[model samples]
Target: MAKRKFKKQIYRYECTMTGEAFKTTREAPNPNDLVSVKAYYELNPDEDDRPEEIKKQLQTEE
Candidate 1:
């Protein structure tokens, strides 16, 4: 049997108010890496806009 490969995805998020950025990697990000990447999301609800922006940027690139 052939081995299946798990691809690592890079996700980036920026704060809408401060322009601060966060980044991380995951094998398969759920809700999105921006939402699940770290514990910061739980602490800062306002920074959750990155997922949709990242999705849009990815779509545009492809």
Candidate 2:
């Protein structure tokens, strides 16, 4: 069996200076044109996401 891939099916954008939403997909601004951009996604929900505690022995070496 082969794994599958997913892509973003939808996107939206607004003007940075005017605060108006774009009316059409073709009119949306490039991400670089915006003052700031934010992307959202999920990662490894079943596993611990934080770094493991450093052992005292290794900490002293650094």
Residue 44 in model 1: shift from native, Å? 9.6
Clashing pairs in 2: none
Q: Give me the candidate number with maximum TM-score.
A: 1
In order, what lDDT does every prediction score?
0.57, 0.44
- The parts of candidate 1 lying over 4 Å away from their true place are 24-62
Model 2 agreement with the true structure over 6-58: per-residue lDDT tens digits = 65445566656546554433434465465321111113334433344633444
**Residue 20, model 1: Cα distance from true site in angstroms:** 1.1
CA displacement after TM-score superposition, residue 9 of candidate 2 (Å): 1.8
